[model samples]
Target chain A: MKGFKTQWSPEEADRWSKEDYLTFVISPLIYFLLALGAIWSLLLLWYGWLTLGICGLLLWLMIKIIDPKLKAISLDYEKKQKEFLEELEKIERWEN
Target chain B: MVSFAWLDWFWLVVFIVLMIVCGVLFYRLGKRSLADFFLAGRGLPWWLPAASVYATHSATDTPMWVSGVIYKYGLRGIWYTFFSAWCAISAFASTRIFRRSLAYTQAEWQTLRFSGLGAELLRGWIAGWQVFMNMFVLGWVGMAMGKLCHYLFNWPEWIGLMLFSSLCAIYVLAAGYWGVVMADFQQGVVAFSVIVIVSIWGIVAAGGPQQIMAKIHSLGESWRLNPLAFSGWTSGDFPLVWFLTMLVIAVIGGFGMGTSIDWYPEAQRIQSARTVRDASYSIWAGSALIVARNSLWAVAVLAFFSLYPRIQDTAQYEMAWYRLGFEFLPVGLVGFFFAAVVAIHISTISTHLNLGASYATRDLYQHYFRPQATDKELVWVGRVTTLILLLGSFLYGLMMKEITQWLIFALWIMTAGIWLPSILQVVWWRFNAWGYLASWMANLGLSWLVVWVLPEFRVIPSLPDYLQFWIMMVLGALIYLPITFLTRPEDMNRLVKYYVMSRPLGWWKPVREEAIKRGLIKPERDLIVGGQP
Candidate 1:
């Protein structure tokens, strides 16, 4: 680990920031549900049976909880990130 | 009954005139300074941002998507992703949060909160990923439009793709965010007015809403009540659990400002709004768009299905929309119809390009190559970065992964990995950073494993998607929650500073004056570029 005197690297911060943007933090479940619905749609076509409805409801129940959960985590991330920034500011501040 | 052929021509002229006017206006403003070019100099008001949100989001795929559902599932079709509308609403509701923060783009938030290498790394990765996704995934949207045009107008896909991309890129690249926002407003108006007119004409042709319902009833009960009707009931063909998962994925995985953070125009546009009220109002207006945008498409599609017998191929399915416009509407109206679709395509493409490139320049290039860059220099780099983005996106268009499947499945999976833990931490006060990280990585690793190890899962006797959704959420939460307490709490001083500066409501202890006087702490009141903290 770097010593307490180490200065912050904007480059590293930017790298993580880019990762944050591209990570798909929130949409995988949507695509998964789409896949499920699509698969069930195919099933209905092949066998003339209706199943996506049942599966869809269950999927909805499962994914619905995650949204609020995502919000909570995001809020927390903001909090932590805030704290981290503040701490850095303090350590980096010159007497001037 | 309808003999106003000039209305069509008039609307078409209006749209073209408006678009050209937008180009001209941007050309003028764009020449002034970088502020005008990139962020409209933070001078944009509520309406333009709201209009951009609506216009850029109302893509060509959406209409076909709505029709697709109705063609297959009936009224239940509306429920397919209708929950996303709530996401739009929530985004607006929280518009103040973003605007209040005063960051030009979401990536800038990384600097405000995390200053060191961690922040830089975060910024770089998120920006790179956003640009990459926009450059790659969004190109397909234009390509799809090309495919649609080819089906309808007998043009080649490449021909239409090049034409569409060139138009959008030319103006967007030339004008930057300033021009795009103005153009987006015009696009929104055109899209709304045209769709409404087309919808009225459709209703008339379908013998009105009552007849449309009657025809739907003729098909089956599911056609009427089943699409958006259920709440719960697992294991059945249309179980509540599956419905629940769909809703969860929409919010958690799809909507929660996760996954595609770069795709978030809300924060950026809000930053440019003249005031908090303007920002909030613009966001709220955008929220209202969710009410009918998707459903409108579904309604249009179902109405179309009511007329057509079979939707055999993708080409036929997409073409039928154009055919309806061409067949039912008169000359000017026909032109409006054409313009609206093209407008939607351009608006979306422009947004993706601008958003993606902003990340590349701001988060990656600026953060790394020139942290000391002047505003003038940064603007040039941003412009050059956009050019590089265009080339990369073009390449992505030519050769890439099978997003056809990702489009169907992986989008939300990526969201779960990218966003869930971070979102969870914000609300659950006890959720430590380590726990959030664990949740993110755990979800990602397991999901990745599923894709790699379980090809058969794709099509077994029935590996239920709901089952996967349910299991993943359950396991992800279960694993992450316990880990929260296991990790160290965030620094207390930093917490206090954030609450004070951002004025976010929280329970951390207030900063004392003695601490500031002693030079042991920084005051929250003095934090814009960087807090005294």
Candidate 2:
């Protein structure tokens, strides 16, 4: 537990970058759109927009609800980890 | 009936020799510990795992399966594979979570995240089912490769199965995860290049892409290009609604719920990634490759339709890609093409063998039997388990005749049943071992009732495959909820530990508060006013 860390270490969150946002945000959006657009186009081509529209609307709703929560939870956890590591370091210095 | 040229043999021999050499180089690396054997010491760069993930999905039968779907339904048939685009959820959400869990296997994650006898039971259950699923996949791919050998050389299918099983087992048993990844990298590149090349050849043979499109246009079967166009219910091809239903299941059920299902080998890759970012990128990169590969196959099948317009038999339709390989590839390259095909088979089989043996040695043997076994003893157990699993899969391959039917059950039906439970395990704190077990059992029994028994009895209208899967998913939820509430909750300490460690962004309000009080973590920036309750 003393040295455990994740790629999104809390110590770096204060210095989060445009690149981080782009990688975490734009990249996934572009990728999913490219993948899902193939399906959407196929659906529209064969079954019309009614089917595609319904799916698109539902997916939009799910993403809207889920995305912010995922971001908040990740940030919260990283912040806690940062504090936890600092606490451990303080204890070690006192013992010395 | 395709015959390989001498150069094909030459390429295959070379491929095998190089693969064995990789096995020997990595042999010492794998002998260190269970982690080294199963997870490559978590030392792989992103691209290696990315390539290995792509290679694992490109089993020998993948092209045949794609060709068959296209022959029946057109290019839209690509949707069937792309349905796994649900993996996009994995790339986004679960990659970091999986890395943070720090569990050896998905089964082992239960102990990390849960508590007491219930977590133990849950661990054993997951480990057992995963082992069974891995063996079945290994055998299914082995059978397909054996049949391909028969198609190419008229050799006894068993001989080819034996050769494949023996060679793969020797390397995989010796070198473990290092061998699996390195071999997968080499094989994935060759297999990908060969498929693309052969497909381009087919396109040229049919006077290029424009001519193939023109030929399709002349036939007035443009419906093939539309991914959503389904033949009517009685036509055997799924209907339009079924396609939509599958999309919903793939997205909502697959992503919104348990994005991290028991894709055991893929899970190993995620764990093996050098960083969490590497794990995330690997999934997206691998999926992009799969998408590219599917498109290439679709184009090849389109050309096949243009060249052989009258071959309508289903069996011949499925084998049309192979026929194209034989007809279009030149003598010297024909062997190279066949070798690439063998490479695909070996990559897939090797991963399954290595993954399955890990589950047996770690979760089953070590956990229950020799909890204090030395690293040397564990690696020995892993090697023996690899050989035994390979032998079992070889026999299973021999007995299977209809590879497609078994594949459907393995891929869709089995997954649908377990999907909900897997999701709940991560997100919901109250979901205990009994709840998971009941969900699995209920999905199995109810799925049989819907897919098989009801149809046989004509109790109601026989549903389409997609409908049946969705219904079972709903039924799984119904079964899980009651069992979870009725069962006692897990030990609270374990719950808090998992909560703070994994930090799963779900319904863990109490655990977070407790973690703060215990000095496990500081309060959040936006904590409630006067938060120390």
Candidate 3:
């Protein structure tokens, strides 16, 4: 939380930053933890619960770090999406 | 053969009707345009496409595949199904980039990413291959259902294949992806609930979790409970090296598009989401559900193993989870289980029917043949292509018995040789269309040589799959890297446009600098915060 950028301008969010890098690290760990945790917990293993709890914390942290950037990116991107879509059609039809 | 009571038949018929009706209700929405037909108008609120992703990947043969691995290797087998974890990083990485580009399919993305003849050729090749691959997958999955039905009711495999796929086609043909996604939601719910019920039932039938563990220990197989248990560093079937290789492939591969075959259908889901955030969450949550679902099936298979430890035959043990349901669930619930199976079957069928058609209609038909096709006409083309794919699947399903091994080999070649190139095409701006194309061609020939031809002639030993992956990757780079440097990079204008749109991660500094120089984007130091620069 200290180092991760929580707030972003549209242009700032458009560029990859430490928040994105942190997410790249955190997201996969959450998946691995969720997977093994689900299996072990179903068998009533204690460590399984702990693993899942950690996974939850990491998931929260990941969202906190990346969600703002994504929101900014999405908000700014949607404004231009119509223009982008038009360009896409031109490419599809070989008119470009 | 298992006998279904009248109640069983009732549940089956009711579920079929419900699924078809749910899908058909969206016919008007699907007929609105090509986007509506293929993508639900790209306005879905994350969860719909999330459910569709979960349901589509949970095909009829999924449990059988899961059961086979879990039964054979205990907890370690979950790693075998862990390839879907690519979505983990992809949710934040490639998924975001692809969502921004807004290509209808991966094939279409090619022409958007590259320019000129090479790009066109790549698009055509990928589109044709996707059409063929989807048909092949449909046949393979349909035949799996046919085999299960034959096993259950002594019905001919063809009847099982034709009956259910055609039934699924009714909704897909009527409503296209709207039908596919909506029905997938209902089917995802049913399939997931049934999976939980049957797995818990199987656990309780094995005298609950504690007793199952005790039995496993008493049977001197406690290692089965340890997820970290490995046979050896690299020699045994469940090797540490192989597990590490899988982790690299699954997790790191997420940064690239088309790294996993699952990315094709997922590309549709990615575009269907209303926003980039929605696209990211849908892929992440959907695959999160899959990871958890596989764990559920793993535990259930372990329960079956504890109950019947001496079973040695692969085919018999592969039916572990299904046997847990039909052999153990009560009479009326047996029908419910079968109905859920139908749900699982058709969810996959509908997705492929629409997915293959998306490639056929969007990339091939409209892009190449009928660029002037209207939205209404394109929607009709989507339907016609869906029908064609369905019919093609039935034929492939009927003949699948003799060609399964070869097609699987074909799939392996598709992944192994081009894995790095698929990633490079995203992260490295210098990875051009000719380089990508050359990788495919080189991999096709080299895979045959390394995997089969040389081994057959005693020129080399039969290498392990993980070893083959590394070898083919190095070998493929030998060809593609030279071709990449020899050929000029993709047109700067095209690269700049893609860079501005996608903002792709990794090694894109040159493109970013160009975009900045062109005043297309601002330098990071000039960023305005709170509307003040």
Candidate 4:
């Protein structure tokens, strides 16, 4: 609760599941992919299939750079929340 | 002369009534205190501010601007919108940093970061600049709405400007930011719905996406589909080098320089989020909407191109978007289109009026005139100032014939010179008020001298706006660095407080040491990096 300011309380983070993470990551990707797909189609229509391969490669590169960072941040956030909960449990046991 | 169907009139009147009712309802919420009035008491859920951000940015001119760019440059013109999209990156990285600072106005942020006459001067200067900038934006959008009205109904421009603006001013005056955000939610939905509906209609009318594609291919311009399409350095209106240069400036100006670059509206949105995570998430949500909005505009423009392949009239090109409304929409839906345009204008103007009033009331009035003023008095002042800003913007809007070119130049070129100072203020401890003052003044003076005066007089050969922008940025930096060193650094206590609170990453060694010495933060071997407070 104290280490960093986050909108997600420990309780909220603890409640988050793999589905939540996947949803969070995929939502933006849907928009991103749709936009890129529309643009790529235009490129392919005008220039031919070769431009598709090039754009696909660039998109893959972008996903490589961006996806891992998003996952890592999500994982790190959960890890911090778990650690924080453990600390809270220890304090509660001691007080009891 | 344009004529509206009865159904169009019905939708327009209904939407106007809906917004006024929402404003009157939120009026009670804003009556509580300064924080409540100006910030919704900083307890808003992430989505509200997110929607507001998207709505506020999608001004009356936004589609016209996008359509104009697409008209001129094809699909690649979307990059122009990318200029502000960089703020989403900033949101991911630094949204909480801004939230944790807890400054009401970015101007008020000075006192938290510095001390002495320097802080006072910096605050005053920022407050003044924010007011002017907000007015400028409101006027710019007002002018667009005026033009839109004239094109839509053959009505006088002022009639359209006054009608929508007065409606916006009344609600904002009654309810403050509470009215702005709540109304923005409805406005954003209407605006975005109209955009999507109109785009789809145009695409269908153009024989679908596949058909539209076939049409584009028939025209056969090599650069038409190329995202990297740009004119060469010497001859074109916007050259390849210019786009690349502007990209660098935008990235540096936003992510590197630390300016939200929405002027102050985006910062206010960030601050309004209830929690730090909410603040950051709001940007992503807002950004997604913005991206979708632009893409939708591209679809409509593509359809426009397909329908009218050889139009040569310049004004017609600019008005292509309005033409689509008249051409494609059903009678009732056409009214919805006009209503949506009004919604866009209201969304933008309301935020600016509310924000401009905050600067005048909180930063200028409360800080200087009545530090001991009660909440009731402050709220009263905020309402009056909102009305004043609305009037000022309307007056200024009437004075201008066209603001599109001036706007492009200001955002793209004039702002390039100020980004460094904005960035350095957060990241560097030694960046004092004098440095900020010098850099901004230098940016304005040198930019005017080099870009305008020199070129007009032929003292130097005229260059493209992008090239002029880069030159201004470099000279502005040249002036900024020496002034930073020449002036004394901000007070040690203030620097340490800023460091401990904001946790900005950069040349903050002295402040970090002081924070450690004062036992404000635990000493660590690894320095805090990337503004992680």
Candidate 5:
């Protein structure tokens, strides 16, 4: 929370930043933990609960870090989407 | 053999009708245009495609595959299923980039990414290959269903294959992907709920988790409980080296397109989402559900191992999950379980039917044959291709017995050598189309040599799969990297357009500078100056 950027302008969000890299690391760890945690917890193992608890915290942190950037990117990108769609159709029809 | 009660028949009939009707209800929406039929007009919020992703990947053979591994290798075998974890990083990376590109299929993305003759050739080759590959997949998955039905009702395998696939094609023909996604939602729920219920029943049947653990411990196999159990560093089947290779392939693969076969269908789902964020979350959440689901099955298989500890035959133990449902669940609930199997079976069928049709219609017919086809005409073409793919699957399914070995070789050819080139094409601005094409060609010949031909001739020893991957990657780079530097780069104009639109990550400095010079995107310095952060 301290180092991660919580707010982003459209242009700033368009570039790759530390938030993206942090997510690239965090996302896979959550997947690994979720798999191991689910099985271990189903067996009623205590460490399984601890693993899952950590996974939840990591997931929340990942979202907090990346969601604002994504929101900014999506908002700005949608405005140009119509023009892009038109160009795509032209390419599809070999008119480009 | 299992016998169905009247109530069981009642459950099966009602569920089949509900699934078909749920899909057909979207008929009006699907017929509105080609986009509606193939992509639900690109308006889905995230959850719809998320459920579709989960349902599509959870086929009839999935439990069998999971059961086989967990039974043979215990908890360590979960890594085999972890290949889907590619979506973990992909959700934030390539999924975002691909969503921005607006390409309907990966084949089409080739032409968008590269220019001129080589790009056209790549697009055509990939499109044709995808059409064939989807048919092959349909056959593979359909035959798995056929095998399951034969095991259950003593029906001929062909009857099981043809009957269910034809039934699923009804909605797919009427509604296309709209039908596939909607039916997948219901089917995903049914299959997941029943999986949970039956796994719990199986665990209880083994006298609960505590008892199961006690039995395993008493049998002197406590290592089975350890998820991190390694046989040795590199000698045994569950080697640490293999695990590290799998982690690299599954996680780092997210940065590239087409790193796995699953990327093809997922590309469609990525585009169907309403926004980049929606697309990202859909892929991430869908795969999260898959990872969670595999854990449930892994534990259930362990329970089965505890109950019947010495099933030496692979075929018999592979039926562990299905046996837990039919051999354990009550009479009426057994029927409900069968209905869920049908749900599982056809959800996969519907997705492939529609997916194969998308490649056939969008890439082949519309782009190459009739580029000016009206939306209405394209929608009809989609239906016709859907019918063609369904019939083609039936033929492929019937002949699968003889071709199974060859199909495995074909899959290896697609994956091992082309993996890095796929990543480079996405992340490196200078990875021209010829380089990518050369990798595919080199992999085809080298896979045969390294995997089979040389080994058969005693020219080299049979290597482990992990070793083969690294060797092929290095060998493929030998060919493609030189070809990349030799050939002219993709036209700067096309690269700039793609860069501005997709904003791809990694090694894109030259293209970014050009985009900045052209005023297409603001410079980083300008952004910082204007932002007041």
Candidate 6:
């Protein structure tokens, strides 16, 4: 009876939510690499060096590593917000 | 220097009488209760509140600053104002968020959201900072009016400040927000009249608007297009990275700061609306005033350039314009301009004092100091605090050695500090209280350290100053977010009770249902308000 109506468990949220994946798991390891990559990329662009390929990779890394979410609200804005807040509230409730 | 003749003084007396008469008229217009005092008793229709916001924001400093910025930098200041125009529209579009909280002040949203003892304590201190800054602005406002008066009539500086301060104080004391609201209409008319007359007079003085623009454009490309060019903190012929930082701070960060204060007058105005549309319209309409008032001042600034092309100091350039008006305006227009100055001063100062006292008395004192105080007592506290704030502000001004760069840094950007993270917390889900607090502290601390230590360390980065400011903001947010997630958003449950009362969560149902019915994520919790977290 509860099929669709059942509340999301913390495990389910952690597994399915993109924010959980992007924020918790992937973020820390990428932070330094991204900033360094941007610097390298810019230097390569100026030199017209074959090294530009690595520079491109670094610059792309920097842009991705920055919280793309804060740039502007995404297309799935309201839907994502609802899910995020719910997952957050659930997380808060669990800690209590 | 043109002086105020007897006729000019007579016109000034007449304008004062009109403000007092309007206040008296409104007092008798069934506005005697507490509602009458603040939020115009929440009964003001859309146009009245809208007009009030427009007029109140047009402080004596508005035109003064405009004249200064234009004469110094050309159209850059006007271009930047459009950024604020975007902010106003952004606030209007986000009405769903601002109106949902239904609190008296933005700080109330903090207490409402995080209902823990710890959060409330944090709330009180943050609230105190806002009240202090609001009052701090009030002190400067008094000083501004005093200076205007001395320029207008050759009155003693202290005498002018006294007259402006006492008038605003007595009216605010007599009618509270009620006097201010009605006085707002009178002031708005006077301000608009002055703006119209001044613009016309200025154009005629400069030959014509087209001629004025042409003369202004002749200065140079740097004067014509560069926002950072006039600021003088630039690299070799170009503004350094700091200018880029200022642009970012003024635009992206400035939006957040302005939005955070969106609902400052609180429940009074919110409750006044017959519908949500009315409430939103009230503010949007108020914003419309900004468009014209901005243009009015910009025109005056252009006029200044046309009239006097080579004064370098920004303040001197602006003073020369106002002095020209006093020296040259017709007797009738002189009265209007004179009245407009007082009108601008009263409208702006009254709102600041009321807002400051509201923060100190309602948000700080009532929320923390004496939570159980009666309504009458709270009202008395608010009124008393207003007087105390005025005196305190004047004293602070008297004691200052000079407004140091640090003071300018804080004064210009503290609104951004409080605003950016606070607004971002709602829009950016990764944001948490810890992140908000850390970024808030870091921005101020780093800015302070930059001033104190940067002068010593001498680590000039590859980027310009403006760009450096942006990098710092980005860095601060980066540092804060991880620390926030590490701490957990779960702490926000402290505010759950208040959230439930205002906007109960749909338990992710809104998202899942929308997505699933449309074939995306699986449906989670159904549309049950309190079904789950």
Which has the greatest lDDT?
Answer: 3
Poorest 10 consecutive residues by lDDT, candidate 6 chain B? B500-509
On residues B1-533, what C-alpha lDDT tens digit does candidate 3 reach at each position?
79999999999999999999999999999999999999999999989999999999999888988888899899999998899999999999999999999999999999878888899999999999999989988998899899889989999999999999999999899999999999999999999999999999999999999999999999999989988899999988888998998898889889999988899999999999999999999999999999999999999999999999989877788889999999999999999999999999999999999999999999999999999899999999998999999899999899876223544475577778988999999999999999999998898889999999999999999998889889999999999999999999899999999999999998988888999999999988789653423
**Which scores better on DockQ, 3 or 4?**
3
Q: Candidate 5: misplaced stretches above 4 Å?
A: B401-411, B529-533
How well is each residue in B1-533 modelled by candidate 4, as lDDT tens digits? 45677988998899899987897798889999888899998788889999999999998788778877777787777777666655544564445456656777788777677777887787888888888878878887888888888877777988877788888888888888899999999998888888778877887888887887778888884465555676776567657787776556545454443354484787788778776667767776787678767867776786788788777655567677777877788777888888888888899999999999998988899887877688899999998888888888888888876556767766754376777678788667788988887887887788778878998999999876767776877888889889889888888876776665566656888887888789876665443432332
lDDT of 1: 0.56
> If scored against the real structure, what TM-score would every candidate get?
0.73, 0.85, 0.98, 0.85, 0.98, 0.72
**Tens-digit lDDT string for candidate 5 (A1-96):** 677776688888899998899899999999999999999999999999999999999999999999988998899899999999999899999998
Candidate number achieving the greatest DockQ relative to the actual structure = 5
Candidate 2 lDDT for residue B42: 72
Instruction: State how far residue B419 of model 6 sits from its true place (Å).
Output: 4.9
**lDDT tens readout by residue for model 2, B1-533:** 66656777898799888877877689999888878899998767779999999999999778878887888778767777666665565665556666656566877777767767777787788788877878787787888888887877788888878788688777898889888998899989998998878877887888876677778888998776555566774355767677676556555443333332335677789888765556666776786678667767777787899888777766677777777887888888888888788888899999999988888988888887777678799999999989888888887888887766676666666667777677677667777777877887887788778888988999968887887777888888888889889988877787777776666645667777888789876666533322121
List the TM values for chain B, per candidate.
0.83, 0.94, 0.97, 0.95, 0.97, 0.83
* Every model: Cα RMSD to truth: 11.7, 7.2, 1.6, 7.7, 1.6, 12.5
Among incorrect, acceptable, medium and high, the docking class of model 6 is: incorrect
- Please, what's the RMSD in Å of model 6? 12.5
**A1-96, model 4: which lDDT tens digit per residue?**
122223432222322234333333443344444444555553335443444455455445444433333333444343443343343223212221
Candidate 2 Cα outliers beyond 4 Å, as residue runs: A1-96, B230-238, B253-262, B526-533
Interface RMSD of 6: 16.4
| lDDT tens readout by residue for model 6, B447-505 | 55554466556664344435445556666767777777787553433434333323322
DockQ of each: 0.03, 0.08, 0.70, 0.06, 0.72, 0.03
Q: Count the backbone clashes (under 3 Å) in each candidate.
A: 112, 1, 0, 1, 0, 16
Ten consecutive residues with minimal summed lDDT in candidate 5 chain B? B402-411
Off by over 4 Å in 4: A1-96, B232-238, B256-260, B525-533
The Cα error of candidate 6 at residue A5, in Å, is 29
